[model samples]
Each structure stands twice: as structure tokens, then as C-alpha cells.
Target: MTSPHSKLHISRSLNRFQTQITIFLPRVAVSKMTVVHIVLIKFRPGVAQEHKDTVIQELNKMKEMDCVKHHRLVVGTSITVPVERSKGFEIALVSFHENAIELDKYRNSEEHLRITTTHIYPHQEESIRFDFEVAPEEEHLWTFLPIPAEN
Candidate 1:
């Protein structure tokens, strides 16, 4: 009483089930974790070397301050197209902490204010910052998959 189409559908379903059983799958989970802040800095044109040096020194001092989990300064290695290339920013500060509140504390602290007003503002021309919260996948994806080491 079975039709030829029904027999063909049953054969295809069995083949698909067998194929799925032979494939390996990776395990992944959602993570509830801390957030991170990303800050980008650009300095003024014709800034003196001494001024740049001083500002860097002040920023480095933040390492001693609590709540700052990590901090780094990187000089731009690539230039953007269309825009006329200038000397570029003196430094880029990347900092990480537990949460946004701690980041706010660091931003509003006396030392931060003093450094900005005294050193960074006078010699700086333009600056920009971008902040983002880390997602669960981003917080733990590396643990399961190996990240290639950079040279």
C-alpha cells in the first residue's frame, strides 16, 4: 500500500541521520562575565617630544593604581586612505577593569584629571574613544579554540 515517493523519503532520512552521526561537533556555552572598555587616543599636530614623553610617563603611572586590570600603549602602524597622513597620535591607551563603575572611577580620579589638564590637554589637538561590552562568546571563545600566537 506504500507509494514509491514514501520509500524514497524514508531512504533519504536514514542517509541524513547516518551522515550527522559521523560528524564531530564542538561544545559551546554562554558566559556571564565582566565588561571591557576600549579607548582610542589621538594627539595634536606639532606636539613636542617632551610633551609626548611627559604624557606617556603620567599614563604609565596608572599601572600602580588599583582597579586597572591591564593597560597598554600602541603607536599606529598603518595609515588610513583618503585622509592626508600626519605624524599620527602620540599614544593609544588600552585599559581593562572589572566593570563600568571601576572604569568611571579611574576616569574621574584626581590623578587622571591632573594628568589630563596638566600634560595631555596642552599638547594635544584631537582625541577619540570607543567603548564596548564583552559578550559571553567573546569572553570564552578562545578557551575552546586555539588562537594562533602572534610573533
Candidate 2:
């Protein structure tokens, strides 16, 4: 049987270890949030279609960069679903970054700046941008009800 003094020492050591673990847990729990960048570009009136295509090509090249987790470049199309919204934006770019640090590097990259100024900015008359950190994916724990068939 352990003496009372030995038991107290063991208890104190365990408490110190638990305290150390509690202090370190936040760093592990608060993981980096994913960053998403969205851009909509409208070329100046009379801008050639070839120039527009080149701009898209340049944007697509950014996808190959290490900082970009995912990238998509798309031209806006006629609204098939009846949704009332502003029109005339010709192109949209959606990019996902692993985290804010990666996105900041991508924003200041030489290729991005060069392509924007030389290939895209001069031809584009209007631009829209949105950036946000995406919410973490949640586990699908709830059951879903069956949908009724439309008659």
C-alpha cells in the first residue's frame, strides 16, 4: 500500500498534467477555417470575345498553384430558372483556399497581379468581389423524411 504522502504526490502530479492538457486543447480544437473568394467580372462594352476567353484561361492557371485548394471559372449564362437578379456580369470566379494565410499569399502572388492588370483589368469595366470563411461541414446525424411524389 502506498503511503499517504506518496498518494498526495501522485494526485498533485496528475492534476498538473490535466491542467497542462486543458491549456493546450484550444490550439488543437480551433483549427484553421477555410477561405473562399468569389469574383464577378463584366468586360467593357465592345471587348472582344477572344480577350474574355484569355482572361478566363489566365484565371484557370491559378488553380494549378499550391495555395489554391480549388478553383472554378465560369461564364454567366441565361437564367433558366426564373430568378430576378441583376444581369450583365459575364464571368464568375470561385476559388477556395486552405486557410486565410494561403489566400493572402495567392492574392499577392506575381502571376495573379500580372494577369489581373495586363489581361483582365484593362478589359473589364465592372467587378464584384466577396470573400468569406466557409463554415465547417457538419455530420448528418438527423434522419430525413421521405418526400411525397408530385401528382
Candidate 3:
């Protein structure tokens, strides 16, 4: 439920499964957190699907930047249940960084500037950005068993 493991409950209501794990570590083990960056975009009226694709394609290139964490990024259409909750936003983007410092580097980098200025800022009606951090070990605990990863 908190950074560096204060208390947490891992659960899946579908199968009625739950597990709790809590542990506090010495200063040396805290290691920084993995940063998550998320954005939701609402395009202006009449923007072509091809234009949208170009924006996303450029955004996807950000994952190849040096500061990205595991080069992990996802861009997809909003599939919010009860579509009204989406507030007219049609797309979403999520990226992971090695830490807060890395996230900042990505945010302020020239590559980021070029991408946004050249591709994203001009075509958008409105956009929302959200970010958070997750403890690496805690994220691992989300699975009851180790699962093979492709990347």
C-alpha cells in the first residue's frame, strides 16, 4: 500500500484470491522506485486516424531513449468501461522509467521536446498526465509465481 513496503494486500476478486506481505528494509535496500508515467489524450475534432497514428508512432520511439526503464512503454486506445468516464479522451500512453531522476531526464530531454513540439502539442485539444512510482519487489509480489517475461 506504500513505497518501500509499509503494508499491502494483493488480490484478485475474480478468483477470490488474496495475499498480504509487508516488510521494511534497511536503508541500503530501498534502491529507488520504478517510475510510471501515464497520459490520456483528447484530440481536436476531425483529426484523421493517420495523423493520430503518426503521433503515436513518434511517442513509441521514446521508449528507445536511454533513460527509459527496460524500454517499457504502452500506447493504446481508451477502453474504459462506461465510456462516459473517459471524459472524451480517446487515447492513453504509459511509460516506465528507472527512477524519478530518469523520469525527469526523459521529461526534459531534447528528444522529448522535439517529439512533443513537432508532433503532439499542435494537434491536441487537451491532454492529461499522471505519474506514480512502484517498488520493484512489491510489483513482483503481484504474481504468486514467477512468470516468464519476454523483455
Q: Which candidate ranks first by lDDT, i.e. highest?
A: 3
Runs of candidate 1 with Cα error greater than 4 angstroms are 1-33, 70-87, 140-151
Candidate 2 lDDT by residue in tens digits, 1-151 = 7333311111112222522111111122323767778888877899998888888888888888788874433334335344335456777887778787678668767678778878878888898989887656631222245669999
The TM-score, computed over Cα atoms with residue i paired to residue i, of candidate 3 is 0.69
Superior candidate under lDDT, 1 versus 3? 3
Q: Any idea what lDDT model 1 has?
A: 0.56
Comparing 2 and 3 on TM-score, the stronger one? 3
lDDT of 1 by residue, 1-151 (tens): 7333311111112222522122222333322344455444566667767777777788878766676654422233225553345335446666665566567667766677678777777766777666556665676542344558999
RMSD to the true structure for each prediction, in A, is 21.2, 16.7, 15.2
**CA shift at 69, candidate 2, in angstroms?**
1.4
Estimated TM-score per prediction? 0.57, 0.62, 0.69
Q: Give the higher-lDDT candidate: 1 or 2.
A: 2
**Candidate structures ordered by lDDT, highest first:** 3, 2, 1
Name model 3 segments beyond 4 Å from true.
Answer: 1-31, 141-151
